[model samples]
Target: MTSAALSFRYVGDSGMDETMNQQLLIDNGLPNSLAPVLSFKALDETHHVLPDVKVSTVFGSDRGNLVVPYGGSYDILRFSGPGKHDVTDVRVTVQRKTEARNPAGSHDVTTQALDSHGRAIEKFERFSAVRLINEDNFPVFVRIAYILWDQPPKGVTQQAVEVTPIGGLTSVPAHGTAVVKVSGKAAAAVARNSYGPAVSIKAYNSQ
Candidate 1:
């Protein structure tokens, strides 16, 4: 309902503390029990989003050509409004993760944006990166899953149509990067002064 910030509740491995180890929750007023929250800016015209979504996480290496990690859940946050007038559809591009290198036993994640449908919006060709899994271990390729949902008012139709590539790891065996683009559509049938639901992101790893 027109929140100043947004957050997520991730449910998976990743080795995160159960006590909401997030910035939005700490900065905002989110509780500790519900962890992995993603905080958004403010509510707007395109804010109305749906629930129950999925995202994909692909891990690569900067030196060889792959990335591997233990696993973990990730979340997302927005900082904009949905708008004033009710509309038909809205599209967005997000850049989750960058030219980062991961070490063994630990995890580092980047931020990815989502459309009204909660799909991983891309900003590059392929959301790819490279990192060292362990000190002596070679690089490994990995992939993760993500979920996106719609915000409030309810009874709204939201869908994730496409995921396009924006940027990727060009310099192989040296350093690599990844980027993705996601698009969605929404049917806003009502118009009035009301706040939408809260936006959240959650991620976890497999055993």
Candidate 2:
């Protein structure tokens, strides 16, 4: 912990006057111009190249995961596209099985048409979202994360998936390739629960 300390200096005319001026300055609790300086730097190549961090609003997806004792309730939803263009306009659609009986009451489909990159493109004209569909009547929890790699190697890490958003989407430069994956749990608690297992979207903005 750091604390401020009282400092005195010679001020004004002669011995007595200088002593009094110094005392006055000290008593006033004034800050000294000569203070310690603090600074920092990027540790390595990775941190240095990354861009500022930003967050995006959560959205829904159609991807579904199987429920088993050890298998888990979440499944992997993959998104692949050309890294050459800025990826946007995602729409999540959740479709429940049509039993031809309970029509309206059997589905819980919500829409967030708002684009993730609204500020960059004004007028709300540019919009994107993902789609979500429930095939086995199981509500799925999908969380997507991303990362940007300038020259990603053609191997496991290149196409690896994670439960958390990977890479730096906000910091992802133009034409840079990024691998984003979703991971979460999904299960219907009540047998009569119509909305299925509710899933929440958590988005991080990487500026």
Candidate 3:
């Protein structure tokens, strides 16, 4: 009763698409009596319901800041298996700067999973930041998290799934551009008979 989990994140401008697709396979090495369940979470960081904020399409101009769109996707698959379960053909498109600017900012993205004991079982990270002037620059930030669960046959207890910065300014100096891109894949395995429901949460700059 083994299981696999996948998670993804993307950040950029409004023109960018934030859609994701993936496949899941369950290996049937054990008995066929075990059942598998699928659960997931999709979050939108740009929109907020608390503190009274409305969703808008414009970036940075209204807030006197650089606005960036960002969010995440998470999923879990469950099934009975005596053979191999194959999950493939996964695709996700993230934000990547193609042009140049005199005072460009930085972009950072990270993914990880933790267990009920608060131990990290899986982790991945990418970061890029730059400064062109002495003035303080506030870049938009977003984060998404996911938790996995494995349900077994009767008489089994549900377990907690181990789910597993800065700068800038400017003096109008250079005429070139700075580009940033983030992309990758992550995978995790959990024992059969274990039960842990998945969860997702996020945070971003609202100012």
Index of the highest-TM-score prediction: 1
Better of 1 and 2 by TM-score: 1
Task: State the TM-score for model 3.
Answer: 0.19
- Can you give the lDDT of residue 28 in candidate 3? 24
lDDT of 1 by residue, 122-144 (tens): 41212232121222223212232
The lowest-lDDT stretch of 10 consecutive residues in candidate 3 is 52-61
Q: Give the Cα error of residue 174 in candidate 2, in Å.
A: 38
Sort the candidates on lDDT, descending order.
1, 3, 2
Per-model clash counts, in order, read: 61, 35, 26
Encode model 2's per-residue lDDT on 1-207: one tens digit a residue: 111332222122123411211010111122211111111111112323112211121111121111111111112222343331122112212232111111111222222222454222211132233222323243322223321112233321121122223222222222221222212221111112212322222222111
Scored by lDDT, model 3 comes in at 0.24
TM-score of 1: 0.22
What overall lDDT goes with each candidate model?
Answer: 0.25, 0.21, 0.24
